[model samples]
Target: MKNIKSLLLLLIITSFGFSSCQKDIVFVEGSGPGGTKPTTYTTKMSAKVDGVLVECEFAYAQQYTNPDGTKDIQIYGIKSAQSFILDFQNFKGVGTYNAADLISSGTYVSGVNDPFNNGHYAESGTIKVTTYNSKVIIGTFEFKAVNTIGEIKTITEGQFVISLEPIPGPTPGNTTTNITAKVDGVATDFTGQAAYVKSTLIGNVMTIVGTNGVKAITIAIYNYKGSGTYEIDIDAQGSYNEDQSQTGSYATENGVKTGKLIITSATSNTIKGTFEFTAPNMVSSLSTKKTITEGKFDMSYTTTTM
Candidate 1:
């Protein structure tokens, strides 16, 4: 969960990149509009110091297309700055990180810390890359901090490697179903126009469909209830679809999302549900279920903690 994309930072193969030497980076906070937009791209890197893991992330999900038409992602990071937050404050920087700044020219290990950020520090382990399907993953890097109080820390080494799949287009139905509703007892109209995507036989159980970003995405009503706890995560896939960050509605830190939804009411063309949010940064590894009978069947996802 914790946007474990940082673990899949398999850079280029040995033939496409420099020799197996230490890599240094010059991390610029932002390129243009300075906000949550990730300045890092196309590389993966991780660190483990002391005993904790200081995972670094790179925003390369928007880049690279494999011949099979999937996204082969890569992430990169900085050695001097393993984390973007400290001191009980979340300090998200403007970009990816630099490695050589903290490690020697050829060595794999590094000294990583942000002296001006939160007063927390650590000694980090080596960063490596692993290959999966059409993508190469990087990370499992650890950063063991000396101070745990008021600090952004990594307790263990974790890895999340997922291939960027293609989002199938909308399915065509003879009936044009419309849904209107208020969220969490609020009387506000839906934000963006919904998209009608044809559901792919993508997963094993849940016949997944639709996008849930700023765009008003039209998903085949999977589970509908008047009032209760619920959750959903909708996203575009691969280079074939537009980037979530570009629309500025990417859920939580990973751009995708995880949340609880509580429905208050529902009808023919109108429905209502209470929406709750969870940080998409880490995985969700728990079986939390809500039952709503007034609506249709149901759907769910597997996740860990953020």
Candidate 2:
């Protein structure tokens, strides 16, 4: 009994001494599925705003490699109709980065009604690159952004892992074949060896450019990532430009009268589709309306991956 009491007293003293010499520290990690450690290069992120769960998506043009070997890595997070852009510039490898300035800092908004009205700028933030390699890129970030309406949001515990690859280009035979269409009841065929097809993804939008002989056509689809029927609008649709002039005669036009694009196949590096639209020449005083039909395009083009 006496030995037990002494042992208890010694344990009490030791516990007190240990507690006195102990220090407490806290570590906050990124939140989400596989946030702490990512196994693959798939752009994904999650954060918290005002103690509420906020989920965000990484944009298509999330990463870009400059000619000088510097890399511009950007990640976008959207939650509750609000969006933010975290821009990390001149980042080549694993290291710490500061928000630097307006250009490099994060930007945010309540909603993006127009493509031109992107969002507001981030006043401050910090990003730590945890992983970077040919296999994958991972990072954690936190920032504060204010909208144009003077609303501020604190983005916290942000982390992302995205697949990395060099920018892609159209296949060798992308422009070798002939692309046929009808314009204003006139049969048109874009042919020749110099003819080329180019497709680019900006954010969620996709723009396909095709040029043959003296005619060039540009088609844009909003939120285009897969096969679907996309409606055409006036301010942002299809156009045909006459390149005969030295200055190039321009046509600011929109799709009218049952204008639609039907995408049949979409892959990582290829897209095939058909389209029909009525385009009006906005540059001319007459506003000449051109009916485009029987349009078909099959091209293998590359994209800039995140």
Candidate 3:
């Protein structure tokens, strides 16, 4: 009887221990019975906005190489009506970056109406990059941002795991292709896929287009010459389209010769230039214009005989 009781007690203890171990075992996202680990992970960003946790449904990172070989990195995430953005100038790999340094900054956008113009800019913050490489970027950030109207937000506990991919451009062996300008005093970065350069086989004509996914700026030069200033007149033209449908379009008046394009360097495969133009609204009968200034582009081109 004593041996039987001892064996039963041992079995109960072993059973309890096995149950506890099973409970403690945690499985990964796809490590269940019929699932396998995903080869690629999705980009993720999450943060607490004034104590409320929010996760971004879409997130992306873009790196732009400047003419001086410095790198500018922009990380963006969007969740519902809110958006978050971080800009790092002269990025030098894994390290802690502060917004007070004036080279790096953060932005928070709320509401869907006029998000671009109504967003808040970071007044103070710190971002610690734990891992940064060609494949991925992992970081934690927090900021105190203020809007134009002085509305403030405290964003905290921010974390991101962003996947990086090469940006395709016309340039061979070049991964960075972007155009930046100031439109009516507002800074704009044209880094979308639509930004490109196309030239004729004879190399007499060229058209360059850049967009920020919302607005597009186009420059067409006729009788193209190397390293020279071109007038925005009959020989060269400029246009600004506000939307994809191009319902609201603006163009420089022909023969008016209001703006100029200065080609600093024009090579067989690449072109570096600066341009500025005043384009009047073509869609509206009323007289309105957009001033594009400090425009710069360093891009490769694809030549066609047709």
TM-scores, in order shown? 0.25, 0.44, 0.44
The parts of candidate 2 lying over 4 Å away from their true place are 1-42, 57-61, 78-80, 100-103, 114-118, 165-218, 221-294, 297-306
Candidate 3 wrongly placed segments (more than 4 Å): 1-40, 115-117, 166-306
Where does the lowest 10-residue lDDT sum fall in candidate 2? 1-10
Better of 1 and 2 by lDDT: 2
lDDT of each candidate versus the true structure: 0.29, 0.53, 0.67
Go through the candidates in order and give the clash count of each. Answer: 54, 1, 0
Cα displacement (Å) at residue 41, model 1: 23
Best lDDT among the predictions, by candidate number: 3
Q: If the candidates were sorted by their TM-score against the true structure, best first, what order would they fall in?
A: 3, 2, 1
Task: Name the lDDT of candidate 2.
Answer: 0.53
lDDT of 2 by residue, 2-108 (tens): 01122112222222221221112222346887556533344555666645656553322245545566767665544434555567677657877776373366655
